[model samples]
Target: MGKAWLPFASYNLWSQFAPPVGQERWYCDMKRGYAKVRKREPEVTAILAEDTQPQRVGLLAQRGVYEFHADAQRLANDDGLAQVSQILRLEQESHGVKERLNQILSKYCENPILLGKRIFSLSRGDEGVPEPIRIRCGNYAFHLFAAIDCIFLEPDGTLHILDFKTGRSDFDERQAFVYLLAASYLYPQRRAIASFYNLELCKWSEPITATASQLNAVRIELMRLAQRHEWEKKQYRKNPVDFERIFPPNPGFQCKHCQFNRICQFSTREIS
Candidate 1:
């Protein structure tokens, strides 16, 4: 996932890195030139988002999954490499397009692709970060992984937090609140900025507020899920949830836009 930014829907990239800065510029005094700038944005509308958490973006991205049975009907139903390759291409191009958007933002504003495939620094006191805490939640332990995008430190060291999003639509404050909870845990007492980047539209938001009330809700959810996960493991000694029960894909706009419609069981059943 080189140059991986809004480029695609892969979570690994989001968790570890971001899109390339197409253009970059000077921040603060413009004293020291920003070394990572690529393509530049002529105008700045909001705070710089640290990045997109893969789960949130993937949840709303273009996805199509097909599970083919190996029964007689499946004999002639094997997907050729072409279709699979097509899927690969879309993911690749989507990633590239996302990178382009990142480039534009970096050029226009002082936003930097701050975090990349680097170890989460946890050393404290001497300017180091500790290992990220991983807690199991509900029955969904390991449900999502998150990281801070950037801590825009003011001259006086005030902090503003921002998040990027690559969803085709549905960019709002809700998702930002999720990351804000994690960021708040990492950097307590510092007021933060949480916003979404609709890279498809090349537009970011202003006043994408981060609220304590919302962050509290996320914390509660995480805690509750962790407790549930503990109970399930002790009781079942394995995953207790059924795939069909937890992830029943109801026909809707997401299904309609799925790329694997032709071979999907749900699609065929709907047509029949």
Candidate 2:
């Protein structure tokens, strides 16, 4: 699928269907269309990360943590890894990134259980893999924007997908399953596992591993979602401004967190 056709009825979107808010699907379509046409990123102003650490913590968490994992994996492989300069360079680039990274890395490095693991991406290494793992199955496509925070490649070839959470909020296991689904496609030959790590709470979740059959079921679901999204997208292209009927909105509490809530008629009760 083309970049123009993203936000394609993602798992999260499908899960949001319900009530009066879901009734205004058209409004949702218009909001998505406006974003695509204008080439704008989703607005994140409404979201406030509870951590005292700056917003940069999250961005650096992805980059810095990946760097750490790559270096550690390379070292395990006896590939003559060079992480000191890498860490130094990262620290020099920004003020808080290094400090935040230390807090995260210390937990892993200090723990004896986490020391021996070789972390790697399911598709490939950090150097070449795309920022968000994009998967396309026919006309229906969904971008896996949520990167797996850390993946441990076991000796037996099991790929463990780990997501690092900095906050205290309850963990959502579905997100990890999404990564596992992506891994199933990216590295079909290997067995895959998924887990969540809460750095703030210092807790590790029970491991969840999916079977080939379960993953195949998810793949089929995604295909159906993609086809339906493609059909609706055509409707959106025909009349971008008036695509309300096809992509109706179900305005309600979800609007409060919606990036498009500011411009949605059902939410604001005013003309856009």
Candidate 3:
């Protein structure tokens, strides 16, 4: 139930978040930054289901919004209570931050793209996509990617991508720009931006827009990346998930609650 692009991702609470490489780094760092980090949901359930969110939101995002829900009942397993405690702590802290951010956003602006959220991957579908598109970049030299969570289409037909942010105010413009490029390449007519929902600040910024030339360049880069991976895969003959040589092994902020945290090679010191 991993994300379409995150071949490296495994399920935690049903594979809910399926965070891309960048987010994985974020997660690892969170665990290290806070000793209280823990697992929020059963890896598989969260990874594979879209029914976990509120019905209204779930229906709005039919593609899947399930991320490890730490508060669910089964999380009470006597084993690994310490880890579970960490997950609960992170989730609650996240909730508090969101409340504050929303309060701030409520006063300054109206909804940017009213009810225009759209998701891309359908991990919860029982039938696998017959011809699902696979995205690869540079024989592991490139970061695997996926887009979901908050597709805000402006009234002027510009599509904006919105991602939820639970912590500080950092933004990844390259990632969003590539998404914009991808949207233009794949959908042709739609204009998309990877927008952020600052759960703490409740503010919106003008998203980075990929110009025609930028989008074209991205397409070339994507093609070259795919070709490079194709050659490496042919030569190495390893599962993409298990392939590690292409990208240097670097763990970052997102691993704290990663399902693979237990097994990530860089997990040298235990975080208890």
Q: Name the best candidate (by TM-score).
A: 2
Worst 10 contiguous positions by lDDT, candidate 1: 26-35
Q: Candidate 2 regions off by >4 Å?
A: 1-57, 67-114, 122-146, 250-256, 265-272
- Looking at model 1, residue 54 earns an lDDT score of 40
Candidate 3: clashing residue pairs, number: 37
Q: In model 3, where do residues sit more than 4 Å from their true spots?
A: 1-146, 190-194, 238-248, 251-258, 264-266
C-alpha-based local distance difference test score of model 1: 0.37
- List, residue by residue over 160-271, the lDDT tens digit for candidate 1: 5544445454544445665665666566776656555443454667645556776556655555544543443344334334322322334434434333343334433353
The candidate scoring highest on lDDT is: 2
Q: Looking at model 3, which ten-residue stretch has the lowest summed lDDT?
A: 8-17
Per-candidate clashes, comma-separated: 30, 17, 37
Judged by lDDT relative to the true structure, which candidate is superior, 2 or 3?
2
- C-alpha RMSD for every candidate: 20.4, 7.7, 12.3
